[model samples]
Target: MVYIAAVVAVVITALVVGDDTRGAAGDPFGADQAIRYIVFLTVGYMLARGLAKAGSWARRDDHG
Candidate 1:
């Protein structure tokens, strides 16, 4: 499940970055854009991890 989420996140992030670059007039590969993409992707992965952990805990509690 984590692997699937990671793959999907990477693909989506790449697509977003690519689109942003193409649509913008100035340099799309600027430092700010790169930083934003990195931040967004990292946050997304963190959220996914947190949710997965929460779900696991919930299941364990229910079983017990």
Candidate 2:
């Protein structure tokens, strides 16, 4: 879980910081980009958590 979150964070950070697809227009950490990063991070976290929970449930069902 921690590993998944870490990877997501790193990937998002790289995209936002790099800003290759979307030009920075001067500020590296532009407010719009910051918002995008935040939104993406939140969604990634939620998905990771849901996946972890589902995996645990499946494992329990398999054993029992």
Candidate 3:
């Protein structure tokens, strides 16, 4: 769900910014940027999940 939301957000952002807004090399929201976006979003999701899991683990009372 998070990944889907991230993709939607990126697409909307690129569309809103317009094609004329592309960077010097080429399309800012082109294939390469899309791949990079996916990779970053996936990594971010994993890190967030890992941190949340760690937090819950730390808060639990194992000796109880």
lDDT of 2: 0.67
lDDT (C-alpha) at residue 51 in model 3: 91
In the range 1-64, model 1's lDDT, one tens digit per residue, is 6655765665566556545545657644555655576678678888988998877745535764
What are the per-residue Cα lDDT tens digits for candidate 3 across 1-64? 7688988887677665547845676564665676678789989989998998877854445775
| 1 or 2, greater by lDDT | 2
Ranking by lDDT: 3, 2, 1
Tens digits of lDDT, candidate 2, 1-64: 6756765665577556755656547646556765676677679888988998877745535765
Cα miss at 35, model 2 (Å)?
A: 0.7
- For candidate 3, which ten residues in a row score worst on lDDT? 14-23
**TM-score (all chains, Cα) for each model:** 0.48, 0.47, 0.57
Model 1 ranges with Cα > 4 A deviation: 1-26, 58-64
> Each candidate's lDDT (Cα)?
0.64, 0.67, 0.74
Task: Please report the TM-score between candidate 3 and the true structure.
Answer: 0.57
Stretches > 4 Å off in candidate 3: 11-25, 58-64
Instruction: State residue 49's C-alpha deviation in candidate 3, in Å.
Output: 0.4
